[model samples]
Target: MDATTGINIAKVVGPSVSIATAGAILSISALYTPLLSNSARSQSSSKPSPTVTLPSIRFIFSRGSHFFPQAATFAAANFGYLAYYSANTAVKVLGMEMGTRTGFVAAAVLSIAIGPITGLMLPVCNNPLREMAELERQGRGDEVDEGELKKMVKRFEWLNYVRGAAILAGGVLGLAVVIAEGK
Candidate 1:
């Protein structure tokens, strides 16, 4: 391929693939949220429904925090730059075909919408879990209620559903753009 063909391919393919990848990762991760509960209904209210112990829960919480930030950092940053470049460079500099240009321009807006939402929402959901994890680590696990934690896990799953839907929608839309552009 010539230099122009390479740049055009990068402009269209890079952002589309990035969004699809991010969406797939988030969606797959969401599937495991139910496991966090590990609920086995009890005969009596005295026993907590979720059997995952506090220490185990804390471990998961600690590990879970680590995963998103890394993904958000690398994936979000990489896509942000690519989509920005695609939208700007493809239309203004590269002068991509009208179909490809429209697709790239639309993708520039659609692709990164999840980053800000996740950025704002994750801390909201994670703060309580973080505090509970820290307390569990410091031998205050007794104070951390597993029932509340279960509720939070449910909320996490719900949040992930919403986020996953949005991100996956972007990915699907990006795929549509790819098809529309015939690239």
Candidate 2:
């Protein structure tokens, strides 16, 4: 491809990747929101007798919450693929400068890393929800171990923040690519 064509492709995909990265960051923030955590806590606290079956975890929190992070992961992955392509185009096709090339490379690497890291942590993060669902199925949600739940919440929070930071870093690197392309 010509330099102009490669530059144009980088220009187009850069903004798209930025937006998706932003969305992923926002969604990750929501996953650890106080309100959601409070809701889960309240639901757990208000459970009926140990013998009575409680509603599934799916019912406790908004079902949409469960799917949002997954969608964010998909979006992150899409951004990674596009960023990788754009970085390649910028470096190989467009013959961008060393600094510019390095930025794109960093962006591409971060984006690529973000998707899998988030995907892997997602299940680990959602383990509590899954456990709650199983507890409900067993009619023993009231018996949930608070210590374990707290530990799970802490793990989820920190891991998700790490994922969000990865996206933020990726977004910044993408901006670097945009700036370099403008030169």
Candidate 3:
């Protein structure tokens, strides 16, 4: 690969590593919140709360941490090889003259930017719905007073689709930037 492609690939490596680390941290936090909340509730209550049978965050982290490096290595190897083959095949089929350096630059930029952008936006779109569903499942289903419920419903109706669309737009913007720069 050319110097530009090499630099681009190297630049992406740090970001990808950071993204993986952040994902691990977020997963741990998700587990911790429920465990800590349950612990606090149990401590305050006369009757012990039902045993929370959720998986352990620490255990998941341990297992995931152990496997992540290997998984990342395999993924990088496979993905790089696939990109090489696919780009070569496409160039041959289309009678285009693009170099592997260009392909590498494109792939590196797109993957680096898109991966974390999607990672960041995914939680924004998903967390509220997940929270609302969890609340409903915990017996808070549509139990708000009529006036409050109406207000909430109206607010949600206005905001829900907007929030989702914003997440999508953010992802698209990231991809667009990568493509524009790579090209």
Candidate-wise lDDT, in order: 0.53, 0.53, 0.38
Please, what are the lDDT tens digits per residue for candidate 1 over residues 1-183? 765565556545544554555665465446555555654444334333333444555665567457644543443343344444443322222334444445544544445555666666568765676676678778776787877877766666676556655555554544554454443
Candidate 3 clashing pairs, residues 3+ apart or interchain: none
Clashing pairs in 2: none
Tell me the tens digit of each residue's lDDT in model 3 across 1-183: 875565456444533443454344344334443342333345553221222211232243247447544533432443354344333322321234445434443433433333444355335533443344445557664542323323332333333334233333322332333344345
Candidate 2 local lDDT, 145-181, one digit each (tens): 5445545545555666676666567666666567665
> If candidate 1 were superposed on the true structure by all CA atoms, what would the RMSD be?
5.9
The worst-scoring run of ten residues by lDDT in candidate 1 lies at 87-96
Stretches off by above 4 angstroms in model 1 are: 1-30, 39-102
Deviation from native of the Cα of residue 13 in model 1, angstroms = 5.1
Error of 2 at 170 (Å): 1.1
Count clashes in each candidate, considering only residues at least 3 apart in sequence or on different chains.
Answer: 0, 0, 0
Compared to the true structure, candidate 3 yields what TM-score?
A: 0.29
Cα deviation of 122, candidate 2, in Å: 5.0
